[model samples]
Target: MFELIEPIATVSFSKVVTEAFLALGMRNYWDGYFAGRAAPLGLAPAEVVHAVFYNFADGEVARHVPWVWGKTTPEEAIAVRERSSATVLRRGIGVLAEAPGLVRVADLAARAAVSAPTEGRALYAALRTLDVPAEPVARLWHAATLLREHRGDGHNAALLAHGIGGTEAHVLMALTLGMRAEKFDRLHHLPTARLAAVVDGLRDRGFVDAVGGFTDAGRQTRERIDALTDELAAPAYDELSADELDELIAGLELIAAARYKRSDD
Candidate 1:
């Protein structure tokens, strides 16, 4: 059971850091930044989000961003990819300036060692050297995004190795995360009839049962995917000694708790 410590810790850290994106995604200030940048390219919000955030196919983006499902053209998405990532980074910086835990997380990341070549660690290292907008919060959020992406990129790889496609992965996620299976279509922006077919296919593959629940085997498989993802992402934390890693995890937990606490209030 304790074998899962690294992945669990890493996932928690990633989620806490990535929460800023969600906060940023909701703010008009960040929206204006993205819209301003996208305007020059003649793309809509959905198109630019699908282009910049996800590197997969348009179909996958459709699965992730509900509004992008039928509203945007693949040609437009492809074209939006040509826009500079600096725009997103700038928007993120602006949002981070107003985020909680700004100085704390930034200071932690600045003191962290890049112990591995995992995408997250490398990105974190690179971001640390940038001009960083002359603001501590922006610098902090920038570093946090790199660390978040590292784990995320690794998770996507693990999902692929598990033979799960983009849509099916979200389906599994909804069910596994305790969301009602019936709500999967609505939540993931998949058509109900089409998602039912995907469900049928998953059932046939022994990943689900007649009632659309994970079989014991299915649960085990998902857990394995998570475990492997954690293992793969473990090297990124190699810079921290065991004690230091634990301390970092505790700090991240506090950050996450603050997020939930604020939401509750």
Candidate 2:
């Protein structure tokens, strides 16, 4: 699912999504990212977006949210995300975008998505309230987005259960992904002192070493969080039969391959 949806979901680098927001008077990366994701929340306050988004720093979300709403209505923003995502996805997959099998994959994924419960999944629920796209390719992208946000909501729950804050989570991910912590701080626009403080807190918890890599305990804890997130996300896939699951994965592979080819080109 990540392979198939990432190209469309990553509005930060998407030509269509970014260009659409530029025309709408949004000039920064966050303007499109925050507005596109929060469109379903409908003129929601920055704090609400910060809470549901979980990973982005509060100030990052605050800089562009309801403010983006001021420049373009939520309906218009949602239309842009949906329309542009569908457009780009179809172009990426070429002729396969029109195959009858594409419709079946969308149908299977949508069934699983809409079947997922809304309790504790705020972002997914908001998207659920909107009409599902009628176009087959658009509907596939929409279903994938619904499922992605659904899992993200669960991921946040897993982190909170283990007492991990958002910044700390990113620090852990930075180590896990072999990325530099300083780079993460810059990307999140985190203050140096604040990031240092978060790293100190993790060190106190024995999750990270002073040298900026995960301690054995830290690795174990991160592993547990990852497992729990998947466990929480498992129920969302319960609606798919074994055969249907196989069918969907195979169908998505074709589209995913095309997207990779398109990206390469």
TM-score of each: 0.58, 0.95
lDDT of 1 by residue, 1-265 (tens): 1232222222312333333233434232233233322232343345545544333334543334433323334343322322223233333334443556556545554344233464433323333343333355444433444455455556767777888765667767877987755675534555578778878888988989888888887788789988887787666667666776676566555555544454476
**Decoy 2 TM-score against native:** 0.95
Among the numbered candidates, top TM-score falls to: 2
Any runs in candidate 1 off by more than 4 Å, and if so which?
A: 1-105, 110-134, 185-188
- Give the root-mean-square deviation of each candidate in angstroms: 9.1, 1.6
lDDT per residue for candidate 2 within 5-89, as digits (tens), equals 4554553248777888888899876698778889899878999999998877558778787788878988988988888878778
Model 1 clashing residue pairs (backbone): none
**What does the lDDT come to for candidate 2?**
0.83
